[model samples]
Target: MIINKILNVDDYYYDVFMAISESLTGFSVNELQSTGLAETYYQHILNQIEMATFIDFLNVSKNVLDNAENKDQLKNAISSQIMDNPATQQIAQSVITLWYLGTWEGAYVNDRSYKEGLVWNVMHAHPPGAKQPGFKSWETKPVNSNS
Candidate 1:
């Protein structure tokens, strides 16, 4: 059923997403299940879909390649629903790659790194070959009654 929809998609967002995910991760559905990584990944995608840069990139990529005009209507409909998110930005990159390149590799020239985002920043990761630790280890924060 998804393949049919993808075939019909002249615009191909969903298809691009699938292609990129497979290419970047090199994992099959069975592998994802075995690793129990699906739930964690789904949540990450949810967050990235909320970033502004990500949404703009996805729209730009989709529109730039559409020449058939077959995708115009769907594009317009999806435009308003577009969510620009950092969390989803990486995923969007893969989709864009699949749309342009026959196959998906990582992202395009942008070269997004897991090293740059909230995951690394908030946690205070140390640079490679650091002389000292970047962040001090911490215990859980205590609850407050200010609420």
Candidate 2:
């Protein structure tokens, strides 16, 4: 997915976020991007940023993540970046939670209505209202699997 630059925030920010997210969550950047993870979680944070302070904070955080020598260093680098301020720490926590739970708890309706949330993939099941099995089907084996 192509991540367009937002104001002063460029694709570099996306790259940095992807790296930090992968290091923190143990999920590949490709997997996150494939499911529009950042679009749902990271973009919400960016959407709320309307000041130079937050922009600068993000840039500094990106720089820290970019310069890390390895995965552990990358995690440490982003952690320190977040620990610099309460606001940043909150954003970091939100990002981590979103990556793990596939929803932002701050919102009233955090449904994966678009069918892109990680929960569907991880559970090997469809979303609650989507593609439910027929009645009583769950009690019987699928014919194809009855070898």
Q: Which numbered prediction scores highest in lDDT against the true structure?
A: 2
Candidate 1 C-alpha lDDT tens digits along 46-109: 4545555544554444443332243455344333332254544445555433333322354322
Could you tell me the TM-score of candidate 2? Answer: 0.59
Lowest summed lDDT across 10 adjacent residues in model 1 is found at 109-118
In TM-score terms, which candidate is top? 2
Candidate 2 ranges with C-alpha deviation above 4 Å: 1-10, 40-42, 51-54, 83-87, 108-115, 119-127, 130-147
Per-residue lDDT over 1-147 for candidate 2, one digit per residue giving the tens place of the 0 to 100 score: 222343343556666666556666667777877765465566665666554644666666667765877767766776676655675776666666677566555552255523565555666655677557568868876545645
RMSD, one per candidate, in order: 16.5, 6.2
lDDT of each: 0.38, 0.61
TM-scores of all models? 0.26, 0.59
lDDT of residue 99 for candidate 2: 72
